[model samples]
Target chain A: MVFSRYNSSHSTAPSAPELPPESYHQPQQQQYQSYYGQPSSIYGQSGGFPAGTQPDVVRAFQMVDRDRSGFIDEHELQQALSSGYQRFNLRTIRLLMFLFKNPYDSLRIGPAEFASLWSCLGHWRAIFERFDRDRSGKIDSMELRDALYSLGYAVPPSVFQVLISKYDNGTGKAGLDFDSFVECGMIVKGLTDKFKEKDKEYRGSATLSYDSFLCMVIPFLVSYD
Target chain B: MVFSRYNSSHSTAPSAPELPPESYHQPQQQQYQSYYGQPSSIYGQSGGFPAGTQPDVVRAFQMVDRDRSGFIDEHELQQALSSGYQRFNLRTIRLLMFLFKNPYDSLRIGPAEFASLWSCLGHWRAIFERFDRDRSGKIDSMELRDALYSLGYAVPPSVFQVLISKYDNGTGKAGLDFDSFVECGMIVKGLTDKFKEKDKEYRGSATLSYDSFLCMVIPFLVSYD
Candidate 1:
C-alpha cells in the first residue's frame, strides 16, 4: 500500500497524459480475430508472444520509432506514449521493457522485441475488455478483484487496498486503465503461479525452507540478471 | 518438481531417522485447552507463543537438549526427532531455526525460542487436525491440497507433485506427519499473507512494481537481519 501511495502521488500531477482510450486500438484487429477466441494462444507454449502478430507489430513499432532509427530507447518510449496521451509510472515502463525481452542488454526496444510487446498488448486489451464489466473504459477495484479471482488468486482486502491505491489516479477513486490493469494482472499471475509451484498437491499450501522460499520468490521480485 | 526429486533422493537413505509421532506432543495441552478452542490466542498479540505454554515448552526443550547444554543444536534436534522416528530434511531444520527466532548468530534453540516454536506447533497441530479429515496421523497429497486451499492457496497439480515428493517418505506413499505438515503450512501462510498485503483491494490480485514486490517478499524468504 505504501508503494502504491508513493507511485500514485508521484505520477498523479495534472501532467498525467490525457490520451483518448481509442488511441490504443489493436493494430490489426481483423487479422487477429481468429486467434482472439483462443485467448491463450497470445502467450505461446513458452508464455511469450506469438510470432504471427509481427507485421502489424512492426507497423506499430515504426509509429513509435519517430526517429526511424529502427530502435526505441526508454526516453523515446515515454515520449511516444505521452504523445499518444498514455502516461505510465516508471515501474510500469521498466516492467514492459523486461517483458518485451530487451536484447543486447542495451535497454532499447528493436523490431523483434517491439513485435513481441505489441502482441502482448493486444492480448492484454482483450483481457481488459473481459473484466471491464461496466464498459466505463476503466476497471474499478471491485472489477479488478473479480478479474484476479478469475485468474486464481484470492487476495485479502487489506492487501487489495494497497494495490488499488497504488494505481488509483489522484482522483481518490480506485480505477485502472487498460495498461494498469494488464500490468497488475501480469504481476499477480506471475507471482501466483510461482507460489502454486510450491503448493504442489494443490493443497493450497506448501512448506518451503527459508532458502528455497528465497530462491523461488527472488526472481519474481527483482529482475537483476 | 526437480527440487523435490533432489530432496527425496538425497534423503532416501535407510539411515534417515524414523521418529515416532507421539514425540511431538502439544507442550501444554491442558493449560492451553482454553486457548486451543479459540485457536487465535496461540499467536498472542506480539505474534509469539502464549505465556501459558511456557512451562511445557521448557520441558520439551529440555527433552531435546539431551546433553543438558541449555540449548538444542541442529544435530540434537535432528537426533531427537529421529529418535522419535520423525526425520526431517535439512531445509526444514534450517527453517525451524529461523522460525524459532534463534537469539545468537549460532544455530541453536534455547528455552525462550523453543517456547515460541512450541506455541506455533500447537496451532499447527490444530490446523493439521482440521485438515486431516480421515483422522489419520499423516496427511496425503489430496488432504494436503484441501488444507492449503482452505488456507487460501489454489495450488496446481504439477506443483502439488513436487511438494508431495519432497516430503513423502520412501514407503511409496505420500504422507506427512505433524511436523512436516506444520512446516509446510507455516511457509504457505507466511507467503500468502505477504502477497495479500499487496493485494489489499481484496481484488484477488495486486500489481507490484519489481522493487516493491521484492521489499515485501524478501523478509518472508530470509532472516538475514
Candidate 2:
C-alpha cells in the first residue's frame, strides 16, 4: 500500500520519459552502470577506462563493444546490464572494477560468462537465448500478463485493466510493447524472464514440474527473498 | 544511490502541519486512534462490527484499527497504511464510506497475528520483542549498527544522524535499540539468516555457530561482493 503511495505520481502515460523509481531502481547512479538499459544520457562518458586493467576487465570491455565500435552504444550496454554481467549491487561492480581496473585486463563479459554468474546464483533467466518468442522484438500485454500470472500475482482481468491503464500508452492504445514493457519491469524483466525461460528449457517439456520450478527459482529467491 | 534521494525526502521531519490534514502531533493522533484501528470504525456511529464477514477482509479492517479507539484518526490510518494491511489505500478508505460498502467482517487484530505480518515485511525500525533484548522502549545504536555492518553497506553515519535527530527529538539523540537493529537485518540481511535463525531457534541454542554465521552473514556477501 505504501508502494502505491510512492507510485501514484508515476508517468501518466506509460510511454512517458520514465516511470517512478521504486526501491529497486536505486542502482542507476553507480559508476559501473555500464551495459544496462538504454543509457539515459548521463551514461557512456567514462572515457575509455585507463590502462593496466585486469585481463577480465580488458576482455569484458572489448567483447561488450560489439561491431568493433570503439565504445559500446546503448543497445550493447542495455543487453549487458539486463544480462548477469551485473546482477548484485554497486559494491560487486566496485569489487569487479577493483579486481580488473587495468584497461588491458578489462573483462568484457560474454553471454556465457554472464550466464554462469547468474546460474551460480540460481538465476536461470540469465540463460535466456533471447526473448520475443514470437520474434516481435518485444513482448506484448497478454504475453506479460500470462507470465506474471505464472509467477502468482493472481492478476485477474480487473488487475489487468488497472495494469494496462497504469502502463499502456501506445498512441491512445492500452498495453505495452517491448520498450514500454521493459521499462515497467525497470529493465529487470530481462532478468526475470531469463529464469522463466530457463525453467522452461530445463524441464525440456513445455510444462514445469513443481520440483523443477523450486529447483530453478528457489536459490535466487532464497538468496534475495 | 537512489536510496539517498528517497531518504532525503521521506526522512525529513514531518513538515509543520500547515494544512488541516497533516496538522497534528503524533500523541494527539494516538489517543484518538487507539480505539479505531479495527473493523469497528465502519460502525463508528453505531459502535460495533456487524457479525458475518469474510475473514481476510475482517482481518484487514481490524489491523487498520491499530488502536482500539472507537474512531480511527487520520494518523492512526497512516500507521496502518505503512503496515501490511492493504485497506489503508487512500481510495479504499474513501470508497468504503461513500459506497456504503462494508466488505469486511470483524476488525480486531490480536497482537500475535500482527506480529507475524510485521515479521514478513517491515521497515527499518520497530520490530517488537525479537531483538529488543533488554525490552527497553527504544533501539540502541550499537546493536543495530553491528547488525547492518554484517549485511554490507556501511550504514552511512548520516542516515543515523538524521533518524536520531528526528525520532529522538526529545532525547536529542536517535540510535537503534536492539529491536530496530534486528528489524534492519531481517529486511536487508537476506534469507540465509531465515534458515539460520530457524535452525537456531529450532535447536534452542543460546550461542550461534559459524555455520549459522556463514548462512546468516556470508551469503549476504553475494549481494555486496
**Interface RMSD for all numbered candidates:** 13.9, 17.9
Model 2 residue B38 lDDT score: 62
Cα error, candidate 2, residue B184 (Å): 5.1
On TM-score, the leading prediction is 1
Stretches of candidate 2 off by over 4 Å are: A1-140, A143-174, A177-180, A184-225, B1-145, B148-225
Residue B91's lDDT in candidate 2: 28
DockQ for model 1 equals: 0.02
Candidate 2, B53-95: lDDT as tens digits: 3344335445666545333433344365354433343322222
lDDT by residue (A1-225, candidate 1, tens digit) is 322222122323212111112222233232234444665453343222234554444444556666544457665665545543356555466556644534333356555455545555555566568888778989888888876654444555665655564455324467777667756755554454455455444443454543354345533332111
Alpha carbon lDDT of residue A139, candidate 2? 53
lDDT leader: 1
Per-residue lDDT tens digits for candidate 1, residues B97-118, read: 6445443423566544565555
